[model samples]
Target chain A: MKVRRSERLVDMTQYLLEHPHTLIPLPFFAKRYNSAKSSISEDLGIIKRTFSLRNRGILETIPGAAGGVRFIPEISETQARVIVNELCERLSEKNRLLPGGYVYLSDLLGEPELLRKVGQIIAAKYKDQKIDAVMTVATKGVPIAQAVSYQLNVPFVIVRRDSKITEGSTVSVNYVSGSSQRIEKMELSKRSLKKGSRVLVVDDFMKGGGTVNGMKGLIEEFEAELVGITVFAESNFSGCRVIDEYHSLLCVEEVDVQTKTISVIPGTYFNK
Target chain B: MKVRRSERLVDMTQYLLEHPHTLIPLPFFAKRYNSAKSSISEDLGIIKRTFSLRNRGILETIPGAAGGVRFIPEISETQARVIVNELCERLSEKNRLLPGGYVYLSDLLGEPELLRKVGQIIAAKYKDQKIDAVMTVATKGVPIAQAVSYQLNVPFVIVRRDSKITEGSTVSVNYVSGSSQRIEKMELSKRSLKKGSRVLVVDDFMKGGGTVNGMKGLIEEFEAELVGITVFAESNFSGCRVIDEYHSLLCVEEVDVQTKTISVIPGTYFNK
Candidate 1:
């Protein structure tokens, strides 16, 4: 496939991010891009060093039979700025978002490159904190929480709205979400934070901050302290009752789910 | 802190797996274990080479203020087997686990060390599948799914039971869970999966296998192919009809929630 220098860097970064379990043979990227293996190596060298110099990532190369390179999910502010700017530009087409006051984020969430950048940005903020764990309610929260937990080197715990037989016994809690609706929820027994454990809570979106606040309450019940709260995006329309130590990757101001017109500004967290 | 050799390996592995965002300063690990920095570096060197030799992971070292060694989550069958065996043995306590019709995996899922290993194993299986994303239904599936997604460096997609304002518009699905008395509800975004995308599905426990099959249907609806399926533990009691191409880390026979007794054998996939 035809590619640009920037696109190649993105593709290479994306590949390493997706294959954290195995190294990519150096020749592999060369063959994929129809470039000499040596040239590919040089390109990777630049990208790797650039990432390191930026304090945004670590490019690791494994030697011998099973050796290749892997990309650690670390992104610097410069990288984040480039990505968020591109995202804002792409989603700027307000007319395409459609009625129902929501812009479709599935495509972006599915992008490996975008996810890596977002994960790195969120993880950077809480790097030194004694975060015992990372928490998010189930489903959409899994991806964001996974990214953060991966960066933080901690197990991620999920809180559920209802109990499933799979979770075994659960600890339940009730809280009012950003929608101002009180909801009852339960966390898997093994998923509870230890007494006085420090946790960082993350999610995909914050419409009312209710879900995140509820998670905070549940963490408190386990004698854990909330170290930080982060979201992929926060709805500007919602009243922000979320804790002071919070971050967002994006902010949405005008969401016309019915009209399909959504205005999204880059999240303030990116500037940090 | 008192540390076991095996536990040291486990902890190092867990530490590396959890912190894919940055390198671990050699001095930091040295202080944590009250060992010499040189000794810590030596241990890390062994780990780095072992992972590289096995085609499982990469050890990246940073040279300065922004530098440290980081372990990207990846392990080969041999390494995975070692960790998995330890996990089964540690959790095999019959008294600690309940015996009934289900297996109590809460404790295992809750512990950071165990969770990290579980994530590594699952991510190892799909190391080269070129998965665009990882998906799991709400509640119990979040942790496992998050774990796998983190190592794979892919975005995690959570399927919710009910729609929330934060998610905007969603596409709903109906499926029968293996143990549930009635058909259950699940949902994802209409825009989550792109056409012809490859998805890896994971869950915490498998009893009836209804939810997984339901996810398969959703994948098909999105015109995406199900690349693989994995679970932490699968129950032998439920004559469940799980799709053919799935794997489980452990096999559980019975769990008594009240009596606190459980029977868990290693999963058949462990042999493979």
Candidate 2:
């Protein structure tokens, strides 16, 4: 009942992916496979090399004093596409999803592992863009901002729906959200980002894409370029100019929170 | 004038520390310092070795395309103690910090760099504890939780002030915060923690240490053992029940937030 090395690598990657910010000792894997520590190390090396070649992750070894190895999730292009498409498909069920034409993303946002991977995929896409910072509106956007900030090594800045005096001076902007019904206001701190800098925007979900456009206006106020935009889930059918360059993990068509039926489709960047 | 290599190394470490997840190209550093790329590489090597020896961080280099270097904040034991003492001193201003006898932590928590360092130190202390997870109560504690989780590579479980049906099911506990006169209820997910596992508890501020005690009770409910306890700031004058194992960066004395007068004392760990 021994697993092959390839099987082990895939299993290990999946396990580590599920357990972000965790280290698994070599002995643990060795015991699981009934193999020597040295053999496990060799297998890990192969996996590490594969990940490195694909620019997807890091396999870190802590030496001595009860040290082990950790895998930090950094996905490759192919992996990102695969994950996005998989999510899109799950979200594309029309009969289940399309209710009043608004996509319900509350469930996906609550999922820890999915959120973590979605963040990694977005960050990797903009890694080389010399982004000065990552920005998103408060509450729902905070998690996505956190993920992108972690991967990009840039500071995560929060834009507030309502301005607070404690944040010091601020710049404000207005844009219409969902279905282009009406414009909404959003504001950000003036000192949060530098002028002529590149900024990456991320959000948990987009309906009207209005908030995304408002964020863009706020960035423009600071003379910063909106280098990239990403959302965990977007409704492509919304027909809004919320994002210029964006990637979505899941695209929703119809969501009925009442009936609990939702339809999902593979995102545009899926499996690319 | 040209900067010395040591200054560059220190600055490099600080810059890398501030940006935990981003990679810096060799050219970026070389351009900043007006040095050759090869020279910059040599400087990075020296810093990397020093970082490893000091147990301050992990400096990783990525090869080609989307490659550069990243500093993962992993402090050494001595560094951990030093940080705890610093926090203790900062919180020591007894007369100035007292706004109804509550030490003002608004300034400390809001500083990005300080919050980041505090998180790294806490994570460093339990670097090998096999922390099935990091735990903290909500609101002010979220930042600390985020920091520790980033360093430890574990998902931080947030104990909420109140439970929502949206959270599924929860286990509730009663504990008195230092600032509050009455005992308040806190909750955690019924499925959040595993049974008989080891957990590290962290909080932003500790006075009566009642919240920590409450957390201990919650852990017991899951049959988990308390591995350790850590606080960013500790008030020695509070005369609270001392945790079996704890660390603080700064000590606060009677603080007067209105008068803006505060007393600070470095902790013993600083000299370690």
lDDT of 2 by residue, A1-272 (tens): 56545445444553454343456888898877777788778777765665565465777777775888876656776777677777766565443233244543434543445655777888766654667778887655766676666555556777877765435467898777666568678887665677998888888777667788888888889999888888877765546464566777666665667767666675555544
DockQ of every candidate: 0.12, 0.03
DockQ of 2: 0.03
lDDT (Cα, tens digit) per residue for candidate 1, span A1-272? 54434334444554554444245798788777777777777667866665565464667788776788866545567767777778766665664464445555655655445665677788777754567788887666766776666555566777777676645567777776556566555564644567888888898877777788788888878878888888887778546565555788778767665555667788868553
How much TM-score does chain B earn in each model? 0.70, 0.67
lDDT of 2 at B122: 70
Compute fnat per model: 0.25, 0.00
lDDT of 1 by residue, B1-272 (tens): 64433334434654564455345787787776677766666667666665565465778777777678966656677777777677666656664554344445654565545565687788777765678789887666766766676577676777877776546567777887767647888888766667888999998877778888889888887889889899887777446465666898887666666666666677756664
**TM values, all candidates:** 0.67, 0.56
Question: Whose TM-score is greatest here?
Answer: 1
For candidate 2 chain B, the 10 contiguous residues with the lowest summed lDDT are B92-101
